[model samples]
Structure formats: C-alpha cells, structure tokens
Target: MTHHNDGVTTMPPTAAAAQAHRRTLLKAGLFGAASMAAGLRAPAVRAQAKRFAGVTINGAAFQHSFHAALKSWLPELEDKTGLKVNFELQSFPIYNQRMDLELSTHGSAYDFCNIGTPYAGRWITSGWMTQLDEFAHNANLTAADWEPGDFARGPLAILSDANGHIFGFPWVAGAIVMGIARSDLLEKAKLPIPATLDELVQTCLRTNAPGKTYAFVNDQLHHWEWPPYLMNEGGTIFRQPPTDLMPMLNTPQAIKAAEIYTQLLSSKCAPPGVLSYTDDQSQRMQLAGRANIRTASIDWLVPLAKLKDSKVRSTVRYAPLPKGPGGSFPGVNANGFGIPVGAKNKEAAWTFIQWALSKASFERMALQKAYVTVPRRSIIATPQFKEAMTINGQDVGQLYIDTVDAPGVSDYMKYRNMAVFPQVGEKINIAISQIISGQANAKTALDQAESAAIADIRKAGVKL
Candidate 1:
C-alpha cells in the first residue's frame, strides 16, 4: 500500500485487492454513522422551513415609531420562523379607515392588525378578534419566558374582553406626559414646571409669544389630547365607564374643563390655526422650538431629545400632566397586535406575535433603537433600558413606568374602554371647537355634545 496526498491509503489495484475487499464492510459502518449525524443537523435546518416557509403573515397597523423600528428587525423574525412577512404600515387615518371597514365586513385582509386603544372595546366585545389564551398557553407554540404578567394591567385590561380573556398584546404605549419644549423660556421667566392646573394656565399666559413661538400646542385629536385636561378638572365622559353607561358630558365639571380648554386656546396662547394641526404638525412645532409646551405620549416626547432634527433637545423638560382639583392624571393608551377572528393563519400569525412581543424583542428595540413605548414593565425596569432611555441624565423610562402605574390605583381611564367612546369623543371634539371659536358658550356646546353622545351610546345598544 502507498499513502498519497489524498490522505487515504492507495494500493496497486491488483496487489491490494484483498485488503480493499476486507475494509469495505468497515467503511460502510463508518459512513452510516457519519450520515446519521448530518441527517440530524439537516432536518433541524429543514424543520424551520417546514414550519412556515411558504406562509406570509399579513398584518397592518397605523404608522408608529415602534412599527418603524420593527421594520429594521424583520430579518430576525423571518429567519427564525422561516416565513415571509408582508405587514403594511399605513398612515394613521388610512389605517383606521381601512380597519373599521374590515371589522364591519368581517374581512380577512389581514392575519393580524393593530388594536387601537379607543377601538379595543368595540373590537373585542364585538367578536372581531381571536382569543389569544390558547396560543399564549400552548407550550409547543410559545416559549415560557414570554411572561404575560410583564404588561401593565391598564393596557392589558384595554385589550381584554368582559370575560377577562386576552385578545391582543400591547406593543405601542401612549403614556401622555408633559413636555416643556422651551424650558429656557420657562426658566427665563423664573417659573418652575407647573405643579397644578392653575400654574399651567398662568405659566402659559406668561410665556405667550404668538408671533415668534406659540406657548401651547395641542393637535386636532381632541379625543386623545383634551381628555386629560377634562379629567384633571374633575370631568368624566361617562359616570363610570364599562359599568355605568351614562353620558356625563354636560356636567358642571365638564363645562369647567371646557372653559379652561377654550380660554387656553382662545387667548392667543396657541397658534392661529391650532385646531387644524395634525399630530405631525403639532410635534414638528414643538421639536422646532416654536412651541413652549406640549402634552403628548412618550412616543412624541422622546423625539424632542432623541431626533437629530430636534431644536429643543437640550432645552426640553418632561413632567407628569399637572395636578388639578380632581387629581394628578397622565393619559395612557396602547395599540397592540391581534389576530382577526376571520383570519386563516391564526397559529402562524401568533408565531410572529409571540416573537414580536418577546422579552428578547423588547430588549433589542429599547437598547438598539431607544423605543421606550414598549408597555412591558420588565423591560422598562432593566438598568440597561433605563440607561438607554435616559436623555441628558433624566430617567425618562421612570416617567413612563410611573404614568403606566398612575391609573392602576382607580382605573380612571376606564372611560376609554367603552365601545362608544370614539363616537362620544367626536362629539367632544366638536364641542371644544365651538367653544374656542365663540360659536357657542362652553355649557351650551357641552350640552349639545352630551345629547349627541347619548344618541351614539344608545345606537351602540349601551343601556343608560
């Protein structure tokens, strides 16, 4: 026998015929063992593909910072599940329009869709979403570390039905805290951040400079922006939402809240066309330092410090929505993904959602993209997250955690959980507009709103 560069013994064919014949059986045994290991490794790789390779998860939601951030991480999801994802992120108005239509018709256009906080009640109770308890509890589908308890109770309640079964998981948190866009302006005037409702008004009036910079800026979404002010002034949309289905829009407390809102806007404390401002417009004015104060969700406030284009990065200060006679309240809302009741791919859709809302996913979003809007308390409690979310040495993540926990004491935001709130909130939008424009007095406008809201609630079959 001769050993060559081939690393195997080679022999003259005639001389080593006997030896080669003898080794054939031994070689076959070795080959079988090697093939078995490779076969095991190959199936593991193939198993990933076999799970969901040809499937494409169709989902959609209003364009949000979290959705935008998730786009960059799609490869991780697609790779792990061996599936393609075709999630369409539309503008807020467009998404809402399409979603309402889909819900009404029971269309299966999306495997999963965003459950807007205001619409959660209507969607869940109407049987438009799939119950997630099965997928969440199944050991084969969901890994144990998902920890449903990590979500804030307020947000989870928003997504659960009357029976307390979960249908959606929160991914977008709307923790409405106050942002001082021009702290330099507040400090130059020797004013501290307002601690009470009265101080907020006086501070805005003192800081008013309409020609150069507006003192206050609130977007056209009165349903979202105006409620905090109304609630702070001891007003409520319903007597007690989800329990007492009565409309309380015309109460003394509500009129008082309206008057406060009207005065703040009509005194030239706001921009000339403030009511026409969209969220993007209002946020732009704040980030450009043309607005002194903005009360909005953390999603918008964080941009004041983190965005490269922010003119007020160094000057912005964060605070809870100021206290009033009723109480100190900060608005919290959420948007999360859920499978449509009409969807065909419920299991695969959850596979995406489970990984999407996983602890690992949240950690990457917060640490890499500074997405503080995640409602998972566990992620927010991390030192790494706190460090990443800190801007100019401020623990902004702490403010989010506090705002989330604020309503846990009494569930003040329960009003938003009623299915008819969106309909009722539209009436409020018109009332506030009329009051601000002098088309009607606060009480008259509010009374008209109360009548309209009652009609809406009744139409939705809510008993009064």
Candidate 2:
C-alpha cells in the first residue's frame, strides 16, 4: 500500500510488515481492553491465511473523540480482517479540497473517506461516491439499530442527491450550531442565562466591558454559527433550497442578525482580533475566561471541560441555541464515513466501517476518557454513558440528546448553484467583516453580499 499527501507518496505496510506491527501494538497493550469491552474473541492462529492487501482512508485529523475511538479500534480491525489500514488525517478546512482533487483526478488514493453531510450530496450527484443503501442493507445495518431521530428522514434526506440515493453512513451526527457558556459566570453576574435572541443581545450588552470579561464571542468565519442566527430570524441566504443562484442574502432578518453581530464586535464584547478567530479560537477564549458565552458545537463541551485550565473545567455549561423570532431555530451539520467510488477493496472497506459502527464498538468508544457522542441510539441511552456525563459535571448531555432528536435546518446541494452554500458563507463572512470594520453598514454590506452571491450562483449554472 502507498499513502500520498502534498505531492509525496510513501509505501505503507506490507502484509508481513503489518503483522509485525500488529504484534508490536498488542505488546504495547492498545487492543486488549477494546477487544474485551466489545466482546471480540480472538481466533485461533490460522496456518498462513490469505492476506487482504491494505487500504488507506482519509478523514479530518483533528483530535476529536471520534478519531480517537477509531484509532482504538484499528488494531482489532487489522487482527480480524488481515487488512492493514492507514488513516490520513487532514484538517476540516482541507479535507474536502483534498478529497475533491483526488476524486477529480481518479486517483486511487483513498478507499474510503469521511465526508460531511453538506458535501455528500454533491459527491453522490457527481458520482464521486458509491450508493451505500444496498451495501448497508446487506450488512444488516438497519436505521432502527442507529438513532432514528439522529438519522431521521428529514436530516437523512439531505445526505442524498436529487435521485434519492444514500451516499454515506452517519458517523458522528449532531447539530453543530448551539451555545456553550460558563454557567458559573452567569450565576456570578446575577443574570438569568438568555434563552431567546433578544435576551441574548441584552445579556451581551449588559455583561460586556473592556478589561473585564465580555458575555459572548462567536466564530466569524464562513461556517455554522451565523447561518443559524439567520435561520432563527426566519431568514435564509438563498430563496430556494440546495442551489445558491437566487439568494435572499440581504433579507431584513439577515441584516438584523448582522447588525447585532456588528454591535457585539464594535462594543468590544468580543476579544481582540476576533475576526481572525475560527471555531477553536472562540472555544479557547470562552474556556480561558476571556469570554463568558460562545456559540459552538455541543460535542465541544466534553473536551472543553477536560482542559488543563481549572477555570474552564469548573465553569463550563451547554445549552440549546437561543430562540429567534422564528422560534428556537438551530443549524444542523453531520460528519460520517463513505465508500469512495471505484474503491479497489470495497468489501474490506465496508467491513472496517461496520466494525467501527457496531453497537459494541460504539459503547466502548463513547465511554472513553474523552466523552465522544456516538450516533448510535443504543449507545446514547446506555446507563454507563449517562453516568459518565453526570460524573464529568456535564448534565446537559440530555440537551444534546434532545437536540439531535428534534427537527433542524439542513444544507443541501440542490438550492443555490449546486454546492454553493460554502461560497455563500464566504460572502457572509466578508459582509460581516465590512460591517464590523465600519467600512459598510449592515444593510449595505448584506446587500452587496446578496448581489454577489446571486451572481456567483447564476454563473455556476444553478437555477433559482
């Protein structure tokens, strides 16, 4: 096997080389507990069994709990399938770019890949990925075994192209646009934590002060946070679904949301260099007492609590997104694994995916030191997981549970020019930056963004 990255490719482990590596891993004690926890009984040594050649999978390489769990199970997979699998981790920002480039060139670089739900539609439609419905059915992986609500019809529908063919399995599924705050800070401030957008704005104004902690800071990049704010206000960047050709980016509600965000920035309610901050920066700022409130993924809370800094450890809390005029509108995003089209070893790739997603493995992974929320319904309801959350002082695990169960707004490729939402997000980011920098008013900035996005979407050949 060979692994390639950044124009460099290197030979991966051979069958004999991998067998030796597996023995070393066993000696170092990486697989014993996971195997036992999953009730995976070791087989008697076979006399020179057929060796399935190795495969490489590409996915986001961040230090997320899901990746850690997958790492824990890799050794066991090697033992069972006789397939040496290599994982190439990329940052989320570059993950899609790399995957698209590989697919476009028809490079046999990855047998499987982890794709976000938003991009899955494009991949399926473009024929970059295989239809997994039959494969999943053959493997006896029923939707019933997984969290029905997490992969409910509404959300799962977004994971398909116009033809309604499923392209990926729900891996680490959850709504990402929500708030995590220092509950202890709100208690100290003698203020009730806001549950509505109006209240949230007031709280920010009241709690913000230079040289003192500000109340709220959000990631200003082209990502999940601002989209929910628009959704909550009953507004959307585009008038139709999936394609970006006919954008309503300058809707009144959108301008209102942008104005509020601009006020927060101008009032210094956010940290210095806030515009340069991404999701991690916002989370770190809140965890370090630089800000009291932040909008981020619910999955982030568990890791944030485990931070070495005592301030964040003792103070953090999680909550659903504040209600907007449209009610408690929140944006949903999903990440999961998919088989790439033309994979050389499709069966072996599916075997690894099935093993990683089995109920047994899900339970073991969720209970790891870092509390990763698995998408399996059975795993979330387990008493052990509940107790773990309680012990870690994170009682809001149920909030995540309930949030995932609820209906949410999903991004599909069909609405604006196919797969243009990310580009729309960039326009929104630029507009917000202009508003905050005082180079343009909220209405003016959003108007320009709306016009530019519409033009771009039209040029992409998507009909409104």
TM-score of each: 0.87, 0.80
**lDDT score, candidate 2:** 0.65
Segments in model 1 whose C-alpha atoms lie over 4 Å from true places: 1-50, 407-410
- Cα lDDT tens digits, model 1, 1-464, are 54579879865577367578558747876888789888888856785656886688788988876788777778777777676778899988789878978977788888989996778888887888899988888989888888787888767767887667998999877878888889999999999999887788889999999787788888877877777788888877788767887888888888887877777777568988887888789899999999888888878888898889999999988988887798866777878889999998988899889878888888888877777787898988898988877877788888888887655522677777777888888999999999888899999999899999888888888789
The number of the candidate with the highest TM-score is 1
Alpha carbon deviation, residue 270, candidate 2 (Å):
0.8
> In terms of TM-score, how similar is model 1 to the real structure?
0.87
Tell me how many clashing residue pairs each candidate has: 0, 10
lDDT of 1 at 342: 90
Error of 1 at 419 (Å): 1.3
Residue clash pairs of candidate 2 = 241-415, 242-414, 242-415, 242-416, 243-414, 243-415, 243-416, 243-417, 244-416, 244-417
